[model samples]
Target: MASGASTKEPAAAPAATAVPDPKMPPPEKPADVRRRSYVILSFWLIVLLLGLPIWWMTTTIYRANLPLDGMIDWADGKACRPVFPLQISIQADALQPQEAQHLVRLIQHAIDDLNDFSGHHLRLQLAPKDDRRIVQKDNPELALTVRLKAGEATTASLDPHSAALDITYPSNAIPSPTSTSSPLATYIANELRSTFSEEQSIISYLLSTSSMSSDVRPQSLTPTDLAELDKRMTRSLRYAATYHLTFSLFADGSTPNTWDIEEAVEKYMRPLLDVLSPIHNFTVDTQLQLYATPGVQSQVLHKEDLASFINAAEWPLSPSIGGAPTVNFVIFAGNQTIALGDSESSAETSQSWLIPQWGTVYLLSLPDATSHVSSNILRQPMLTFGGHLLTLLGTPQAGSLPLRLSALTRIRSADLLLRSSSTLGSLARLSRSLPSISIPRTVADGVATSMYHLERACSNLGGLEGLMHARIAEEEAERAFFEKSMVGQLYFPDEHKVAVYLPLLGPVGVPLVLGLIKELKQWSKKRKEKAKEAREKKQQ
Candidate 1:
């Protein structure tokens, strides 16, 4: 009866639970509970404040911000559309301004009708009477100057020494104000077209091969024509700031060992070199290799033999000791004559065959006793070398020397523009494909500089300004794409993070987790005890 009365509502019910659950190990001492809580808090504090930061600092890679969208635009040909607007000046000092302007208008109309490629445009400007100059200091767009004079017949002749055309027309051939199509104007247009036909073809060829929009590319290039142009393009060496010209004389026998090559070069090659100095800087070095046998021993060198003619093992034609590409011009003194047993236009005969992109091999037949090759004897060879050199430099087949050189400048600018664009595109694609790849600051700087120069180049496509910028763009793009630091992280990847962090995380994590669990259980038990005590106090 007394136990039942007390059991009705024991006010100290919470105190009875002070022992905690029997299944739970035991009620921890206050000091022990506080110590375990401190331990767990310390572990978490270290993980959040110290450990995480250290891990990030050690494991994170440096990634510089890049112009990824701009790079993509350039790669896809949406950034720049290359165009060559060739400016030609027409000089007509004898006629009135109005008459000459009319003639110019007619000639321009004829030219426009003839031109098909939109990328290559020929703009004609009438020259001022006081100063008839080919090129002004401020205007570098003058490709060719045409001088018009009245004579007995319409005649046009190119200035062999300079980029000028002297055209004489009959007095009656001069266009009247009322005439829409004058014979004189038509003749001049035909002559000008004839002069620039080669340049137009080459530019058309370049646009066709490039990764440009179809709107700018030539639409009329036949498969055969494309193949021929491609072959010629392949035979030309890649553009460089400097070219090492190695002139090596290989003699099968002891005779003809010494050549007056330096003098010959000065006389024959210097002028041409000076002309080309703007586009390319050339370093000339001559070597004499006696008792050197060419790979082809047979007298009559077939087309197949011309390929293996240069003895790479024996000749000291190793690349020049620099970054510049080497163009080896080897002259081998032998008694062999090329066998032309089949058919050929007799006027197109030659004793020299150009080894594509490498150099030219001229087989000169010298007297057996002669130990020295005179400058006179080397005349034909030097001239042959000059022609081949132009071809090797990707000059068009038909054009005056000055015109060809001028055209070459434009061609090279276009070529470099396409090349740098392709390189940038490749780098952009690489970055997109490899998201985990680390990029160094240097590479980002290089890419930025390259894009900057490329923009400048695109702005000045025809002038020398464009060529210089395009060159810089190419070099920078190459450096950025081949950056060594960017390649290292390719070996280490995201999956590697699991292996690296797991070893340290697994061992340290288990004890910290268990401590946290124990601390939380104590906290939960204390919270329940406080609530029950509050209820009993209220009931009493």
Candidate 2:
């Protein structure tokens, strides 16, 4: 017992000696431990409630609510089906009401047989036989009226001023009440079909080439027709309400620097421009380029030489300031004559040709010594250019100037509608595919404007109102799709995120987590001891 007590005493003495010295205040409180705990908690809270939310709020994309399903449906041809209902009037001046009715029925049957495309329907109506002549003079919208007269077998001819089909046919040919068809009806139907054949083919081609389904299209088009349509499409600019026409006169030497283009444009082009005002708005600026050189230096240009005639790099035919597309018509006055290829039989006249999607170039060959190109000298070239301008704008070849321009408006409206819809589709796809891109409020506003205009344009197609709405829709869609800030921010990548996190988070997180764990362990041990003491006291 004494040995055991002595050993125990030594142990107790060492333990007592091991007790903390009161002189050394409780080992300076672990400031780092407390600091680390606060740091960890603050960091976690910030990351959870503040940091993450700030990041999300700052970086998240602001995508405008788009009718994506509806847009897709439109693109897929499930939204609206296109139809053209043509109204043709018949005026039988030589016949009674019964005969006129019979003639109209016969003509309708004949037209039905002639027309293979179901989308375009021609309905015949009887025009009033009035001598007042006001209706005949005013109404051009009435596609055509058959003016039948009793005479020898007559031919079909369209009146120059009116949409009147003059047919002086034998009275015997008029269909009886019992008859369903007649020779005159067949002749009229054939003439009408021939007259509208080009338009029908063009519409059919447009429908087929567009995003619409193939089922809506008619039979396969001939290779020649397809080529023509492709040519037309290539030449035509994308639709816009306004067009900026830049008329430039480029000369190799510095003599003909000044042209009376302002006067010439006002005199010749202005009239045409005025006529086309309903369809397109025009702004013209004339410039004279001195010391300009052609891309090809050959004195006699071959067919290949034409491709390199305009030095695009040197030519200052930059697009205009406004959003409207710029079309350049250059009158290059030089002494050089262009030669057709090696073939001597080929005769390419006017020394002028059109550049697809760009403009027309006319080479005027004058005396080598002559300097100035006066307005009189420009008259012929300007006229040529004006004609080419119409072609370049995809105006139909048929019909009078006024009629062609009216058709142009309709075609352009359709073009703008399709383009805007396509742009909307692209924007939707881009937003869905690129999750990181930040969309701005401006984009939302533009999208809303675009959708509204698109709806309006779709509802009011085939008229001036449709053109206006389509133009607005196209502009808005382009703005939304090409929002500058959205594209600008893509440069800041995830690599940048990792780069920022490594330095601060790495060093700071370690100490904070370790302190938190230590505090938890210490608290747990103290709680266990207190519980044990309470149990011992109870037992006692």
Candidate 3:
């Protein structure tokens, strides 16, 4: 009983208490945790705000603005309708002015009745027949003057060099003001129509080839004619403001090195070039290449050999340095005959074969001892080459040289217009297809320029201005569609982006976020404990 009492009394005594020493300064006051937290928050804010903006700004590409919708519209033939208005003046020198007017009116009415195409219109004007002083001059004031001379019967013939229609009509065949139709008037109208029929057909074909109205296409173009057109198109080079015509003498062996090309070109080719000057500028340069070898080295060239006869890689017939299109006319001195593959056994072999979109190659059989190509020997080749060049440039087969060249200008302009439109369409489609590709300001500028030029070309489709504008439009459209900035960057795959970000963001962000979260939790807990202690103190 005594031991039990001593144990209970001893429990009432104050338990032994352990106190901390005062010299340690309470574990340094926890190192100002709020200040450390403020420093870390400021560091994270700077990293998030200031650093990323600069990096993103530096890595981006400069994109231009292009009128994609408008470009597509133009490409789709929704904009710009092409029209060709031809002015035909008639000068009836022998007839009275009133009679000439009546005749012109009648012919115009007949022409209108005969014409079917709505896009092309032929407006007739009567020139002063009494202006003999002007008509006799070397430079006449007329496109075509109808000299109605008295004859046994009415007949018409065009002047070889001039745009003159000589109509010799009998005095009795003249139409009266009251007559609706006359043999003379019908003959004149039919002749004029016949003369311009080829031009009309060609223009119709061109319009059909282009993205023109579907309603106005010609129905008379046969498959043979279409095939011919295709061949002509394939043979022709793309139109340019200036064409560099290179006349090269390529010989299989090292003989006939020299040529009188300057004289020959001046005498033979210069006239045609001068004639074509109005439509296109021609730059001529001749070269004599020796020791040139053919691609197929055979004594007797088969018909198929002609296709691969010219050594494309080895020949020095490279394009000219100028920006203009280069047309190479080569004359090889070898005795190889070229025949068509379809007619292998035919003796009617061709002496020359045209390289599509290039120039012509003439297989000249010359004596081995010949050292120089005389102008006489070059005459036929030069003429043939000139003809081929005309064909290659898409000159109309019918009509006089001047008329054909005029048609060629119109054709080229149409081609350029269509090509530019197509390019714009492609650009618009590309912009739509690749949404991520940035459209640059340069591309916008190019598109604008192209559209402007396209409009100008459309307005002036029959003249030199049309050609210039069409060319500019084509070049600009090409530039806009192929803008380098638009294709600068690739769409980064999601997997690749994740691969790049995971490496740095995974390790760095995890620790940073955890550290901040832990610090916040500790601070909240401490605040709660302080509040509870303050309440307890106040209550005591």
TM-score of each: 0.88, 0.80, 0.80
**lDDT (CA) for every model shown?**
0.84, 0.75, 0.76
Clash-forming residue pairs, model 2: none
**Candidate 3: where is the Cα deviation over 4 Å?**
1-37, 40-44, 130-154, 167-193, 200-220, 252-254, 296-302, 339-347, 490-540
Q: Which candidate leads the pack in lDDT?
A: 1
**What lDDT is obtained when candidate 1 is compared to the true structure?**
0.84
Where does model 1 exceed 4 Å of error?
Answer: 1-26, 138-141, 217-219, 342-350, 525-540
Candidate 3 residue 353 C-alpha distance from true site, Å: 2.3
lDDT for each residue of candidate 2 in 1-540, tens digit (9 for 90 to 100): 565554434344353546675685555366865676677678679778997799788856675566667656655656545444555677787799888988888888999988887555678887777752655565434455667778888687766554466778887887788986788889988887876666667677777677545245464689998998988988877666678898988888876767788888888788889977877888888788989999988667777888888898998886765778888899888876666557644575447888877888888887665777777888988898789889878888875565466556656766777677777777777777777787888887887788788777777665677779889988998898888988886677889988987897788778767767877897698789999999999999
Q: Pick the candidate with the highest TM-score.
A: 1
lDDT tens digits, residue span 27-70, model 1: 66889878878878988999999999998998778788888888
For candidate 3, the 10 contiguous residues with the lowest summed lDDT are 135-144
Q: Candidate 1, 456: how far from true, in Å?
A: 2.1
Rank candidates by lDDT, best first: 1, 3, 2
Off by over 4 Å in 2: 1-52, 85-98, 109-114, 118-124, 131-151, 158-168, 212-215, 251-260, 289-293, 297-300, 313-319, 339-348, 367-377, 489-495, 526-540
Q: Is candidate 1 or candidate 2 better by TM-score?
A: 1
Q: Write the per-residue lDDT of candidate 3 for residues 335-392, one digit (tens) a residue.
A: 7776545555657666887888878888888988799888888899989988988988
TM-score of 3: 0.80
Candidates 1 and 2, the one with greater lDDT? 1
Residue clash pairs of candidate 3: 63-440, 64-439, 64-440, 64-441, 65-440
